[model samples]
Target chain A: MYAFFIRTFEGSKTQVELLKEKIRQDGKVLSEEVLKVDSFLNHQIDPVLMQEIGKEFVARFSDQNITKIVTIESSGIAPATMAGLILGVPVVFARKRKSLTLTDHLYSAKVHSFTKNESNDISVSKDFISNEDTVLLIDDFLANGQAALGLIDIAEQAGAKIAGVGIVIEKAFQPGGELIRKAGIRLESLAELQSLQDGKVQFVGEEAF
Target chain B: MYAFFIRTFEGSKTQVELLKEKIRQDGKVLSEEVLKVDSFLNHQIDPVLMQEIGKEFVARFSDQNITKIVTIESSGIAPATMAGLILGVPVVFARKRKSLTLTDHLYSAKVHSFTKNESNDISVSKDFISNEDTVLLIDDFLANGQAALGLIDIAEQAGAKIAGVGIVIEKAFQPGGELIRKAGIRLESLAELQSLQDGKVQFVGEEAF
Candidate 1:
């Protein structure tokens, strides 16, 4: 079994429970007009907290032979870079749009951003990922599986091995975590949210969704 | 005089010459079918190299009393983050697109990317940059000066004081640097390119551009 499987199956279930509680306490609920986490988790908050999340991810997947840590650009780059620093690996972020620095020959995949309510092509330079690479995909949030699937497609096109997916927070009520589990790939999440009820964030294994 | 300005004015002449020699040795020529890097000095390559170039930037601007390192994102975030880390200040990257994560109230500006051949609306959350902030603007390239001007505008909107502007590589042949200089802003660049000859990268002084 994978290292995360050991932790999730046999290790501290109470630790996970504590983290959920911490998230509820630390993460603020914005106005009902705003999304659930317009402050800490998603938008503007603490970098130190994010770095700790990165460390937890590194510990969870310490057994995997990860080559490159892949993440989408912007917010994901911060946590991914932190994880890369811990693992001593290079962090390659997928670009939402093509730029001059990017190579012409690239592995391209389409991703739908539920937050933006739009679709865009994400790409990685051909020179960045090699066939022998074992990739650890990292992201801040996983509400839907679309972005992760797009990253998987890019990794496959480059012939890189998918070691596993590491997420800081996963909306367990959503289809994202379920889809990755169904794919038979190991998925490790630091925190899981059951749902947002009446503008308050709730956790799974405790109560309502 | 700032150490960066002193070093740039004195040390950069030699560094620019050295960079030119390196580029001539390592730089590759592109077919018309491929993207040329001349526009890259102003447009494409500038933003990508921001992070790598930021190490030198921090050393130059080390004496400044900077509270936060700010940059208009989608491009400027790279160097801004690196500088933030070195300066021990929080780097706030302005968002290029509205997402579910953002609040309705924001300090917004419109920046035109010459390379992408389009204009984008950029914003920072009100909670990020405050009136008490002393910001150092970091950008990859300084070309026509619109992007930098837009960032300055955003900083002003937040009532933040401007410490200075840090640029990775400046295209001295263009009016961007000259304009910023005329505005009396402290603009420091690691490498300044005088011109491009037959796809060859040329430097302003003796250092690499």
Candidate 2:
């Protein structure tokens, strides 16, 4: 696998700054308040970059004995998976949409997506999480704290210990980061954008933790 | 990264057989036609096994000069990303539920999920796929041809060549596998189960291809 895909990626790179550069360059400023990172973050993914982001997550939360990584469906799957791969932990993603084949016995929570402007119920199989496990919630973006809180709520319902939340990008100006911080839950964001004004990204820097 | 999670897995392991064994032993058979592999395939993932599955995809589609790996959202992402890592190609997954941030410029297709008993319109950003790419479609399961055909239809819309379709499990009894093969597509399933009866899995064997 290594022999197949190997290239010079500047050997050492800063996860936070690289993501910010991607947002500034490839990101679309839909509005003064919104930034779309579809090119690298969501719609079109850079797997190699995601692997780098995943490694950064493991490095940030190296001390926590994270037994399992939890996240919401779709967007969170990629980065969360990369972390799962590096951390050697199973990733249990909460499903936003339940298929007809889904078991009735499950743990579920209502999550509101600020971006989508809609609230949806997300569920996880009861068999996946255990009381002895420590869960780290991860997602692509943290806005309004809806999805993260929802995942944390689900983990709590499963009686799993809350390790922390690993976010790829966090809108520091938004209440999500503040809310998670106030709750005394550990949160690590690779890139924290303080403001998305006039299409320029303001890094939250060391204060992002 | 590999050093952090490396454990001795027999290097000569057969990908197809291992997956079949997983389905037979751990897979939940809800009924005659339905098999739930959510424990490992979806809800909670065994990252190590997924890595092996990914390597096998790279092995099978080692030729055809695959430039990109594609799949519909959620379940397909993990294995596709793994393949992306080994093959050094970018992995792109179609989004099932569109976030409000998504741009209107896109190639979209409707897919019917037999398990979900619903039809969803999955879309890929127009910027991701190009006419030059040779895409290898990967998925956790290939039940009905709906998802694959939908993705292929989207790729054709983008004028991208279809390299092949790699499925972890293919229900040979269903029309999905047959449909892809009839369309003169290179279809590779790591484990093709002919029938799942009374909690037992019957393989399609090498004759499946």
**Best-fitting candidate, scored by TM-score:** 2
The sequence of per-residue lDDT tens digits that candidate 2 reaches over residues B162-181 is 99899988887889988998
Interface DockQ of each model: 0.09, 0.55
lDDT tens per residue, model 1, B7-116: 12223444334434434654444531122333222112222233335556776777778888877544455456546644556777777763334447788787776666
lDDT of each: 0.66, 0.81
Model 1 gets an lDDT of 0.66
- Steric overlap count per candidate: 12, 0
lDDT of 2 at A207: 32
lDDT of 2 by residue, A55-158 (tens): 77888888889999998878888888878987778898888863324547788888877676777889888888889999889999887998888888888998
TM per candidate comes to: 0.76, 0.91
**Candidate 1, CAPRI quality class derived from DockQ:** incorrect
Specify the highest-lDDT model's number.
Answer: 2
